[model samples]
Target: MPFGKVPVLEIDGKVLNQSTAITRYLSKKAGLAGSDDWESLLIDIAVDNIHDLRQEIASYFYDPNEVTREAKYAPLINETIPFYMDKFEKTVEENNGYFVNGKLSWADLFFVAILSYLNSSVKIDLLEGRPKLRALKEQVLAVPQIKAWVAKRPTDIP
Candidate 1:
């Protein structure tokens, strides 16, 4: 596999690595990218920002040293999470419960998809008090295709 990764996707005998690249390609084909170039740009911005936040969470959660891990937790919970979540909540609220263009895009699906992993890493409900974010989660999960997929997808991972 290219990059020796599990997420590599092979289509028409061509291999694609990296989750973001694969997701973007599928999103475009699935009509979830955006309505136009500008909207797609906005979706890309949101997805990139989400990726940055995920990197921060992963850095703290994956550190093997207990003391350093403990040290990172406080700032992550107190500052990092709220800083990002608040902006995300506001964006969702402004966009009428979607990440961009007031409609469902790959960005919304991306955030909702990784939320459980984020919560598991942090050991807390990241959307606990954020109503808009909670609504956004509900909105995405309520999609018939996503709902069916969630019901049938393997639950082996936490």
Candidate 2:
């Protein structure tokens, strides 16, 4: 409620706001943040990049005017998405299917978690043709904890 946001987390009578801050805090507690400062920095970089791309997609997805939306979609689908996705693909390949430290980090989880929302907004599989990214997604979702959650998560959203 600090920023009137729905994602605020109440912990031990204290409130935490902002999705990134909350995710980072939880990642640290969950052992998914990173192994060290350098690794954490790398994870932060990847997460920030993904967030930037998500904002771009949301801009196009939320536009009210059809004409402007179509105009925005052209460059977004043809250029922006490919540009960011290609970079992500190469990064995942270099890291051996993870976003940072060549192992599971919050960045990987964050990317995989938001991917469905992103795809839904665009109506296309962003991972299509990006084998490394697709594989990363599979790897994250295959985690026992995440898989179990996915099985029970709400399916009402398209």
Candidate 3:
């Protein structure tokens, strides 16, 4: 806290670190949050379960550490990303169109973010063989704000 970066959430002049923790806190404040209960646990599970894999997949595609032919993308394409994506799809369906509940929440936003990542960085035919999941994503995408975001979303990320 003595010599840290900007965007500090000081409580009585105490700085807070950890971006994920801070985002989680803010998600709660906005009601786009989750609970500590069992069912609510899935929300965190779903988000975390996919983040690392998605990041790795993105790095594979866009990171200069990666080459032009998508060599780093093999594992993700052949196994990892699809595996977790399928799990999330099932989780969404099993929970009845939401990640861990019956309403749109942070989990939906998480899914949308991940889908955007997939569309930009990789070729994920999300609905190709998973019609239900595709339809679910489409349904979420149809919402006005999110839809506008998607329409104006940037495809070029370096």
Give the winner by TM-score. 1
Decreasing lDDT order of the candidates: 1, 2, 3
Q: 84-154 in candidate 2: lDDT tens per residue?
A: 99999999999988998689999999999899899999999999999999999889989999999889988
Off by over 4 Å in 3: 1-19, 62-70, 148-158
* lDDT (C-alpha, whole model) for all candidates: 0.94, 0.93, 0.69
- Please, what are the lDDT tens digits per residue for candidate 1 over residues 1-158? 87787799999999889989899999999999988999999999999999999999999999999999999999999999999999999999999988898999999999999999999999989998899999999999999999999899889854
Tell me the alpha-carbon RMSD of every candidate. Answer: 0.9, 1.1, 4.3
What C-alpha lDDT, on a 0 to 100 scale, does residue 25 get in candidate 1? 94
Candidate 3 Cα lDDT to native: 0.69
Pairs clashing in candidate 1?
A: none
Query: What ordering of candidates by TM-score runs from best to worst?
Result: 1, 2, 3
lDDT of 3 by residue, 90-140 (tens): 877787887777666676776665675576677666445666567677778
C-alpha TM-score for every candidate: 0.97, 0.96, 0.68
